[model samples]
Target: MAGGLLRWPVVLCLLNTLIISPVRSTVWTAGSAAMTQGTAVVVGAAAVSSTDEHFVCATLDWWPPEKCDYGTCAWGLASLLNLNLSSHILLNAIKAFSPLKIRLGGSLQDKVIYETEYPQEPCRPFVKNSSEMFGFTEGCLPLSRWDQLNEFFRESGATIIFGLNALNGRVPLSDGSLGGPWDYTNAASLIRYTVNKGYRISGWELGNELSGSGVGARINADQYAEDLMNLDRVVDQTYKGYQFKPLVIGPGGFFDANWFNEFIVKAKSSLDVISHHIYNLGPGVDQNLVEKILNPSYLDGEASTFSNLRDILKSTGASTSAWVGEAGGAYNSGRHLVTNAFVFSFWYLDQLGMSSLYDTKTYCRQSLIGGNYGLLNTTTFKPNPDYYSALLWHRLMGPKVLSTKFNGTKMIRAYAHCARDSKGITLLLLNLDRNSTAQVVVDPGTAQLSAVKYHRGGVKEIKMGEEITREEYHLTAMDGNLHSQTVLLNGKILDLDAQGGIPVLESVKVDALQPINVAALSIVFAHMPSFYAPACV
Candidate 1:
């Protein structure tokens, strides 16, 4: 009897282990529950007009180059000494996104004086001791240097939107405002020089932050309008024989409703693009950088500015399209790890998605290589996390914007586009959820299903019969620190080679029939190479 009892217990234990042990892996299924409670992302075939092709652009600061020490430059000691305009690494990276647009303007731009002759000696770098904002000693961009810059841009397929000095030699008015019948002799000479040399410039932006409620010294709207007219005359006169004339854009300042309305009205039709700058998240020193970026509500707040500007342009009957000419989330050179890190993508990518919806024609990121916010590391000239994010966006997202609906928590934000040069759709899914993982199933909607069968809209119950393949390019931090600059794509770290060459993008194949498992606190770009949406083609 005792031997029989022992054998029975052993047998029961084995059965219990077989029945209760966890499965080797858990494949989270997507169903009505996922649609109802988790996240249901539906992408429609209806197409918005082709978005601005040059939507992703970058800027170059006016600060003269200096020695780099651990990615941080001594702003005070910095002179235009170390900037290799044709650095192999820099040009190679820029060429990756060929036909790139780079704006050569910043705070120090207003202080610059264009010297027709090359300086006998390089300008001595000096720091100004002043309480005023952006108070830096004068720097000169010699004609010889400008030629070198033009050659660099031409070779790299970059178009330049050069900012001319508006505050240089301006007369301070009785009202304590900077009044300008601004001096354009130097500027005009430079324009003539550029046109004479046959350098292809896309635009000539007049001033930086001198528009409405200007930086430190305000410029009246009426005065700025006159200045633009002067610059316009110069451009027209200089490019008379040329086939293409560069665009004239200006008033690149923070959007103040009163200031922007007045400037647009005064500038009239002279402006080619209505430009504005936004650093919505305030200064970089704020301690809540992580929280602010992760919060969707904070990210959504920037939309109001976009809407207001568009409305103003429409109300004024201006033909100019709106451009977020300069935006770098937090000002004051940006936070070290926060701006340069992978977490910044949540903010950067969201801006790209949100701005397109509001009809923003072009968005230029501040400081392509100077400040801490640069897409590339200042010292090493290595592509930062945001660089890869921008590259993936440039490679995958097309000009046509598609409508996407996410019926779930705001944690999962989604944007869709027709894949560039391909007969398919691309979806950018950002899982901002701090804890819960999201399983996303792409519903191609009625248009995609009907086209699959009869090559047109007909059946309501049409299904994708075969397994559809998808390529997912995920951008996530290896260890989970949001501020870490180390980014992993499809489970591999992207590092430069011995020759400073960037690695080719790798993707993991996923079946469209299955749910896409989006890990928490990550960004996934799913490319459907098969679903040929009409808008995409």
Candidate 2:
């Protein structure tokens, strides 16, 4: 150990491994022994991944009170139809980011009917029906509700991406698939209405989980392609003379490489983004939820999905973006206590770090506020632990992602990027091991870590005016309880104030010479202002 000790921060996330294959194999390539008991290692940083400026996004689902999973009515008024748009705390949470992307849709998106220009059936709320598709009869979104949502979005300065119903005109067929060309008449009317009203929608997504065998209902790739072309035409015609138009996003479902490649090859350039969903942690009701969160091998399973998606997009030569349309680690509204706890940060932040490496354009969490996976509480509307993690990442991590690799202990995952604001780079070190502490060092391409035994060579003289102190935000579970909804920064509880305002995310300044020590199961966001990176400039 050197004179300055670097205590290991606790960040326990199974990772977005840079490997391939969606299957969860218990084989730990990086050494399971080290995962169980931490190890000393070096993190090398260089290169930059192409990532979008708006890389962080969260979803707002339309699941009504009747929607239940595992015998629990997890959703309580967080739907697009009933969310309290007047929540001041919600407003502040969105505003705290200066600007945050909100994706409005979910499983019921395909079931939604936009009542812009009323016609056929009376526009009404969804009525639960076990005999019908998705366990509910058809639902309607009156233009009045649309108006309210738009107003709230404008007030929050949120970037909006709405999911439109793709099953509108199609007839349900055999094997959970839909048949027929999409009747764009009503949908076009809705889009035109949104345009005429001047509601700023960043993107209008086509459907939800309607690909790769589908979740509720599947659509043929060929037909879906035609539908995408139909959608593009609708968008073009609606924004005919406008200089800027909302983006056309689609096929939000779990990654199915063949389905995606076929859709891409067929859809051609009509698609702006090839979106997908992630529920890699399995059903939310799994008993070993915590074990899965702590296991390195399990987290590594998702890499194949991210890796294959990247390759597919590149191979097709289609100029489109790749976004994780929606991801809630565990499906079925996620585990009540686990998904909503401080421990979920391990999974959430890990996904953020890993997806960026694969050049993911945008990542939309399963929820901003809905179900157990929401960033905010379902009823109280208080911010969750993952909310703070997202906020810190947005505030400190810049769009330019630097290539980072750790040489030891899969228990400790590493990610680096240009600082969100400043003249340097930021490194995020996560320690997943709860019983063991891993000592580690960083290799900044511009300057080497001096006098450390693990230093990989390059050393530069310390400049006089350089910022010698590092700003570190240490995150851990309050009262050492991982299931606690509360979070701590630098050992202080993070709680919002009255009147629904977000609390300041403060960091502690440490001498650059001090040793970087991460304790068991903690998270450290280190902003190295003095460390130089060419990509940042």
Candidate 3:
């Protein structure tokens, strides 16, 4: 028995067998072995499947940023801080009172920037007359709703951006052909009500996507300028306490540079933010095509459009910051698989990184939840792949940007974040490639890792209820092919993969060389465990 205990017979053997055999079999199984002892033969075994499939690592970057709140948020004062979910409308109606600041708004304007979302949903077909529209309006929150939403924003550490109804609620089209002599009363009332309720409205957009009217109401640039200018005057005079007139936003979609330039020149000093939208997919495109569209470089194209606008704004001396108020997947519902899949993590991370370079201060995703673009799923209120991705970014990325570089031939992208917390710095890596893997470097510091966590999935289409497959998992961060073989730790290659993950040397100095990898179609975040200060890296 003593001899048997001494010779444990390699309790667990690592087998690289394809476990996708009989569908009924589980991927992991238990195994046993018999060891010959001096007195007797003892049988012992262990249950082991490949547990090293998902890989993630983090290193401390000497530079860190000020701690700030960052994460996936919704549109307008109401959504930024609160979820409107409720079994009863009246009960949920309380959401309007708690308002959050820094919301993303303007669906009507989305059309002008994207040349879409212009055609308004024909008022509920069931509404036979004004009474029904009133009933529907009662069920829904209108301009008055902003009062409560703004309160929530203030209490929750956020601000408000109210999307006005430039398309409906004012002009009655005998044939519904975009008729409005202009009703500053309701619009003016909205601005006054916000002030009366003591809610600070950071910006008040004229109309959402009025440039093309694809989904809402299409109006010429000149016409939009007129409406915006008129509304600007009323809001400015009525809310003098605001110090500045609410920011007027326009051209919500389609990258309308011509319209943006024209509006800037004609409506000088009137509009604060030149809003825009973008969607990256061709309808009915194949999976391969979708994967190609999810590339980080694609962001470069989107950024270029903003760059052109930024240059124009600088030339015109416009003071308003560029705000991506409304944007998400191609369809109202997200991409069939791409957006909902882990692939979105790469896209989102790049967005945060690029926003600073392009001088964009604020970026509002389409929805917090609801529509495919929402950060949370409407039905489950559970975080989606994007939600988890947002959570990591919010928790790690701080107020200031840090310097880091990425050199790669394939698609696994990387970004580094430094903050003044004991958790050390975090390196974010995304394996955008649906099939191939890629490796990364993680610089180690004095703090050794206390723990590690990773999120991975198969292909880009693995939907709800499906388990990620072993092949897919392994392919995500497969050693040499998908990751860099020589991961330098404090300047030396450490055999960390023997256990699988980025290594953290205990009691190491602040600047340590760390190597990490991003598995295909996965998001990897590394958290350092120890004690330190909070600052911008």
Give the top-scoring candidate (TM-score).
2
- The CA lDDT at 228 in model 1 is 87
> Where is the poorest 10-residue window by lDDT in model 3?
55-64
lDDT string, candidate 1, 1-537, tens digits: 000010101011222243222112222221112322344443445675446786788888766444223455523212233367757888888888876778878777787777765445664443553553565576777777678888888888887888888886688899778985888988887888888798988999988887666776678888888888888888899899878999998878788888888878888878888788879888877889889998989988998998888889889998888887888898877888988888999999999888877778888997677666888887778888899998898889888888777766788888888887775778888888777667665666655665553211111122324334667887777577788888988767888877777789987765443455666788888887765566665
> Candidate 1's error at 319, in angstroms?
1.4
Among these predictions, the greatest lDDT belongs to 2
- Candidates in descending lDDT order: 2, 1, 3
lDDT of 2 by residue, 294-363 (tens): 8878888888888899999889998988999999999999998899998899999999998988979899
| Candidate 3 lDDT score at position 130 | 31
Model 2 residue 492 CA deviation (Å) reads 0.6
TM-score of each: 0.86, 0.89, 0.58
lDDT of 3 by residue, 1-537 (tens): 000111111111114222222122121101113111111000001111111111111100100011111222222222322345232322221122222223444342221111112223321111113343212221123333344555445554445566655653345445433555445555565566667767766677666555654344555666567777887787778877656566677656566767777777787777777776655553323345355555666655666865787788888887766766665645334543455444454566666555544555555665555444555444444434554344345544444333344555435554444422423345555556554434443322212122211111101122234433221001111132212212222223333233222233221222111222333454555443321212221
Select the stronger candidate by lDDT from 1 and 2: 2
